[model samples]
Every structure is written in C-alpha cells, then in structure tokens.
Target: MLVSTRLGAARQIADEAALALRPEHPEYFSAIPPPDPKALRSDVGGDLSQLFLLLALVCLFIGAVGIANTTLVSVMERTAEIELGRALGARGLHITVQFLAESTLLGLLGGLVGTSLGMVGVVVVCAVQKWTPVLATRAEFVAASSPCRNW
Candidate 1:
C-alpha cells in the first residue's frame, strides 16, 4: 500500500498509516518514517566504500606481485651481463642500485600508462553518450574534504 502526502508531511502520514493499520492488521503494519531512507543510503554508501577499499588493496597486491615478477625475470635474463659487470669491478651495491632504479622507472611508467588509458576511456564513454564533460571542482573539493572535516 502506497500513500502520498504533501511535502513535509511524511511523518504525519506515516503515523496515520500506522494508526489505521496497526489495529486490525497488526501483522501488516510496518511503519518506516522519513529518516529510514537516509539511513539506508548512508549504510549502502559505507558498504560500497568498504568494497572499493578492498578492491583497491587487492589491485595494489596484484600490481606489486607483477612488478616483482618482472624485476626477477629481467634480473634472470641479464645474469650474464650482471656477471660481466661484477668481473669488471662493479660492486654489489652498484648492481643493487641499478636494479632498484630500473624497477622504480618501470613502476612509474606503468602508472603513467594506466592513467592515460583511464582518461581516454572516460573521454570515449562521455563522447559516446553525447554528454558534455563537466568538472564540478567545488563538489569534488567538498567531497574530498568531508572525511577530513575541513569542508
């Protein structure tokens, strides 16, 4: 059963509904006041945030594993070159630093490529939808600042 009331009369209508139904049909009288929808919205938002955080952690783990595997493979394939460098008086520290720099560069490049692809995908989707891409900077700032209580 659905009942529509004028604006700002939800509570009154809800109470009326409860009063009317609770007497004869006690089993069917479930009164949900106006605040319930807001509460449910917050609850769903919290659940979605937790889900996104979990997904982000999983993706970070996968990316770390991929970087480590790539670094290991590069080192393995360059074993001969590394031995040659050592024979020519390259210290262990030098080799370690070289590998570290290579891995750092690889990670940075991966991030840049991923960012570019994501931007392109967003643009493509917007174009396909014939929607103008609007940047709501104020809303973004408010949302970003809300968690810090600085908004």
Candidate 2:
C-alpha cells in the first residue's frame, strides 16, 4: 500500500491516476506524496543532532566538575598528611606536585583500563554480530585518554 515516484513527471502521472480513481472509490481512497529526504532531514535531523551535541557537552561539563570537586574534598580531608609533609620540610611546590602526580596517575590508570575493557566489549559484540572490530592505534588511544587540550 505504498507508492513512490522518483520523477516530478511521474508524480504528476500518479496524481492524475489517483484523481481518475477518486470518483469510483468516493472517499475511501487517496493519494499521498512520498517525503523528500533532504527536506525531512533538514527539518528534523538538524534539531536532533544539535540536541544530542548539547547533551554530550552537558555530560562532559558535569564530569569535569565532579573530578574537580572530588580533588578538592580529597585535599581538604588530607590536611593532617599535608601538615606532616610540611613538618618534614617538604616545600609547598613539592606538595602540589605530589597531589598532581597522584591525581594524574590514578586518572590515567583508570582511563587506560576503561578503554581496554570497552575495546574488549566492542570486539565481543562485533564477533557476535559477525562484524569487523576497529580499534584505535597507540597515538589515538593516548590522545583520547589524555584530557588536557590547548585551544
């Protein structure tokens, strides 16, 4: 019960055919034009794509804020340790570097492990569906795992 005409002239032919049948069928039958893919995509796909991009941006913002908040809480909670370091003659720069190193190592470790597990999952699913598994190279992997970027 679906009809499609590629050419405008064919559409006109179909329209005339529908009109010829209309009197016999009275109100029971009607002819409708197939949608224009480009126009439909512009109208709906544009909004949907923008909406998803916005959603991804919001998620990234929330994750960065969460990481910052957690780091702050951790430093605040380790006041005794920081004081001990200072008492042992550790300079402020040393303490700062120590915290940054700890945070970076932990973050990098988690990122690598997570990415590995995700790749494994992708391979498993692709195998199950009979598809080829694509994986990132070392440079691409490192780039994706690293967060800091210059504008």
By lDDT, the best candidate is 1
52-90, model 2: which lDDT tens digit per residue?
678767855775676667778889999999999999999
Question: What TM-score, over all chains together, does every model reach?
Answer: 0.70, 0.56
Weakest 10 consecutive residues of candidate 2 by summed lDDT = 142-151
- Alpha-carbon shift of residue 139 in model 1 (angstroms): 15
Tens-digit lDDT track for model 1 on 44-113? Answer: 9898888877876787689889999999999999999999999999999999999999999998788667
Runs in model 1 deviating more than 4 A are 1-8, 21-28, 33-46, 134-151
RMSD, every candidate, angstroms = 5.9, 8.0
Q: What is the C-alpha lDDT of each candidate?
A: 0.73, 0.68
Q: In model 1, where is the ten-residue run with the lowest total lDDT?
A: 142-151
